[model samples]
Target chain A: MKNDILTVMWKERKGLFRIRGRRAQALLGMFSPVLLAIFFPLQEGVEWVQSPLSLLLAFVAPLILVGMSIPDSFAGERERHTLPTLLASRLSDRAILFGKMITSVAFGWGVTLVLLAIGLVTVNIAHWDGHILFYKPSILLADLAFSFLVAMLTAGAGVLFSLRAATAQEAQQTLMAVLLIPPMILQFGLFAIMGSDSGKARLQEVLGALSFEQIILVIVAVLLVLDVVLLMAAMSRFKRARLILD
Target chain B: MPSGIIFGFLGPNGAGKTTTINLLLGLLEPTSGRAEVLGLDTRTQPDEVRTRTGALLEHSGVYEQLSAEDNLEFYGRIWRMPATERQARIKELLSHMGVWERRKERVGTWSKGMKQKLALARAMLHRPPLVFLDEPTAGLDVMAAAAVRDDLEALAGREGVTVFLTTHNMAEAERLCSQVAVIREGKLVAIGDPDDLRARSGGPRLEIVGRGFDENALGLLRARPEITAAEVHGDHLVIDLRQETDTAPLVSLMVSAGVQVEEVRRGKASLEEVFLTLMEEER
Candidate 1:
């Protein structure tokens, strides 16, 4: 199983790096995170490492990266006429699924970590506080967990969308829309809560009641569950015969 | 099911040739029946069957974005060939196909013929006991098709691999396949050695090329007990004779009818003729 998965990964990685005519799109994908990593660290000074809000960058970074990559990996294989041959190989269905998912998630999560590290160094150098400034351990852990979970979420949803979409562009569009729903709902929920004086007060009271660690923990748990559900959904949708027919 | 021969699966488009190949490779499950490959039940031991066989599917199945060497390297690893041996084998196969110098170039940049050759090399790289090739020379120009046919002939002969080839090219099937199976609409029509099929479809045929043939002459020829069927084919009169009987009587009859016979040649029907007869019989 390990060897099979690795073989799929090797192919996935080769395809990812060897993409043609999409370099500009790839750089554009990295542009936002890179700009934020540099500009935010420079503008926010040492506050960049001290605030829990920095977790937003971590989450969105991977969401964008993995969202872009997972669809291309899955639907792109079908569109480029390579999926049937790969399915005909000795590799099991799970091996192909997990291999591609891991490659995309790792790429997104790995690059986010790099950007985070670069952001930290940039902040330290610009502020020159005569001490090495770093994100608090709690915030760092939250960022890692959040970023990894979002990457998995995007990848899982991407797989599901790619399975039905006739083209990579269609899958990417559908997956991006799916990924945006939760945040959009959250924004509406927040607006509803803030619209009422008593609701706002109660929300603040509850927030004040719970420790920051507890909030971060709750968020991580929710994301973890979501990631698992989406992963299972994607897995159930994948079948060698179905894919061949498709 | 014999060992070490090029077995041709002949079928027309939409005749389920690719589906059959997929079934044997264990990539597709039969709706009712089951299949076995290399002694492994395809349904139960699909992975084993796939690991032991190779396929150049309908589309060549080559990664166009990668170099020829990379494509072979990837599949070699899939077959778990060792590093040294894999490299040596890749070099050997590419060199054998006369595409060694272009191995470093991406397959997308190569001509369709070269890509087909590379794909064939990849299929033979692991030297599996069985290989499936679907229309390997389907769309190539005459020269390119001949080149690919030569390569296929050489590799099939040299490696002693069992080739399950699918094609609509009757001439190719006649030349390369020792045994052939004809399928139409998901059903097997005939399966046997090419010669047997040609013989079974009809007995010896006689072709007389001359312009002095008319409907009266054809009617007279068809009336003979030795000739089963007679028709004007292009500018010639073709007769399907029964039981290797002499054509002298038919020729004498034609002469008596004031018809001229420019040439007389007697031989078995070609595979194309056999295939057409099978399809006609099926319909």
Candidate 2:
């Protein structure tokens, strides 16, 4: 029964994504994944880029894609007034939420999946100069699992934010501000605070010393639980009245 | 047998017409009143009702990007209509609504009338007995509105499907609705056949046209217990007389009051007048 709803949701969202054609949503989505791949990927091997480019490959791209895209998909629905229509349908609010959440996370993860493919091709090409990082599809697959969960978190948060904004732009803006802040902070070397580098390391250097894989797992797990809880919360707040007015 | 009732609901603006329709379709919560569709309470049996009902609430809700047939197919899946049935029904509905030629065309590319017609087709696609239409002709031109009215009338009269329709167009209501409930300010003012409501609010009307008509005199007639309505049309006063009241008495009252009376014509009450009078009472 749950899978039934999820399947329908996947179909519906696939339609939504297919609304304008995958030529754009899927392509434009690649933009962020590629940027993150180029910049966020572990450097060749500076004692910091751990677990072969393949493991880090599985983790970071999915996480970033989920964090960046899922919420925005919700904003798209809120903008299109499709949410209100969906709410009025026969499906229970939970089913609707679950379906929509699935779409968001799936799309987010989907984009990451595409990016991973592109990155894999590019990573192999880049490593042609005698630097062969560990090559394991299972490591990449595990990262995908974590990415899906994080995508749920972003999607739930986006939907919750959508309830507060009148239009898609407002929802995206509000969520974007919230979502962008953490990454900006992290980019500013704030992540260095968690590093265990012992000597001659400033704030960023120390944060950079911790293994990226451990950080990814802890963050993915925490975000996964929060995402599930927030989705339930979003489902509860997902009433017809709020949808029409919101 | 049709699983859904093409229930007919009619209410004027501000009468919670939109709100009521929304509630019926599970688009909104009823502040007090509860609605049941297909033997299911809208609140608890939303899924059952939705699956059974095909609604065109307000206007076109097409995804706009998809073609007309695509929209119908999408909604068909949502209603759990069979995959094999989806395409055939979409074609049938689009043809019935006279949009089959444009089935492959995007909804966003269609005109307002076309969009509305397509929306109606989509609503009727699932063969749901219960269809809720909230001013489906709202944005159409006169000819389109008439076409829609004809379609609704045919659906109800020929198909025997109960259609719940809400429209401010009294003529449309009179033509399309077997029974209408006039609502104002969230309260139901009157409920019955249009003819019955008109007949019940009856008075033999004396249509008098004359020069220098005393406007205040008509007001006096309205004040009288016997006069149900006194409508001033340019130089004429179309008066509705009470059952117990005779036209002779009105002539006498005018004579006694020293007023000149012109040609008097007795006429039946119109639904428009009856509803206007009902709304007046509500105000």
Candidate 3:
């Protein structure tokens, strides 16, 4: 089983950037993350490393990257007419599922880490006041754990949508729409609440009751639960007979 | 169904050929009956069954963005073949298929025929004892189709592997398959060797190239109790005879009736005719 998963990963790695026009899209996609890595540090100085501003990059980078990848990993096989052959091979279901999930998470998380590092370097160089600037220990931990969890969330959701999608582009479009909904609603809800004086005071009071560490832990726990639930759903949906019919 | 021979599965569009292949490969489970490939029950031991067989399904299933060698290498790893052995086998199969020189070229850039050839090589990479090919040469031009057929025949012969081939091309089946089964509307309509099906569907036929095939000769030939049907096309006369009817009497009767007989050829129905006849019967 381990070898089977590794074999699938090997294939996914080879074909990662080989999808038609995908390399160009990837380079184009990198532009924003690269900009964020450089721009935010220059604008915010040491505050970029010391505050939660970098967490935005950490969350959004993996979500977007994994959103772009997991669909292609899953739906691209069906669109290209390669999934049946892969399923017809000696590989088991879990092997294929885990292999694709691992590759997508790795790609998304790996790129986010690189961008975070680039942000760190930018801060140290631009703000050469004294010692090298680095992300605070708490922020660093959140960036790593949060980015990873987000990648998993996207991958898990991507598989479910990809199974029903006729093409990779369709899967990506649907997945992006679905993923953006929760965050969009949250942002609007925050805005609506902050618009009122009572809501603002009540919100601050609730937040003030908890330490920063407890809040971070709460967010991490919620994400962790969603990740497992989505993963389980993906596994249940990844049956050989079902995929062949699809 | 036998070892060391090509078994042709013939059917028209939507005739469940692809479904049967899927069931046999254990990619889809049968709703009613069970099947076994290499002594492993398809429903119970699909992995073991798949591990020992190869399949070229409805689509070629090659990664167009990858080179021919990489395509084979990926499946090779899926089968868990050792690196050195897999490399040697890929080279051997590609060379046999006459695509070894272009192994590094991306498959998407190649013509459809070339891609089909590469797909065939991928199916045979593991040297399995049996392979299921669903319409392997379905949409190729005449020359390309013949080339693929030739490669399939050679490889099957040299390796002594059993091939379960599905095709709509009757001439291809006549040339390659030792046994064939024809299905219609999810039911087996006919199953036998090509000759056996031909004989069952039709009778002896005689064609004589001649002039002076007038109505008199035609009526006389048709009136014979042993003859089933008689027709003429310009200088040629065709006669379908009852089983075991001697051609000498028919030729003499034609000659005496003033029909000039140039050449006589004896044959049975071709596989195409047999297939059509079976389909007509089902309808």
Those runs of model 3 whose alpha carbons end farther than 4 Å from true positions after fitting are B233-235
Off by over 4 Å in 2: A2-29, A35-78, A129-142, A183-216, B1-8, B31-33, B206-232, B235-237, B244-266
Interface DockQ of each model: 0.67, 0.36, 0.87
Query: Which has the better DockQ: candidate 1, or candidate 2?
Result: 1
Q: Scored by CA lDDT, what does every candidate get?
A: 0.88, 0.66, 0.91
Question: Which candidate gets the maximum TM-score versus the true structure?
Answer: 3
Tens digits of lDDT, candidate 2, B153-199 = 66556555567888888777777666778888878788876767887
Model 1 pairs in collision: none
Clashes of 1: 0
lDDT, candidate 2, equals: 0.66
Better of 1 and 2 by lDDT: 1
Return the top candidate by DockQ. 3
Report fnat in order of the candidates: 0.60, 0.37, 0.87
Better lDDT candidate (1, 3): 3
The DockQ score of candidate 2 comes to 0.36
Docking class of 3: high
Give the per-prediction TM-score of chain B: 0.96, 0.81, 0.95
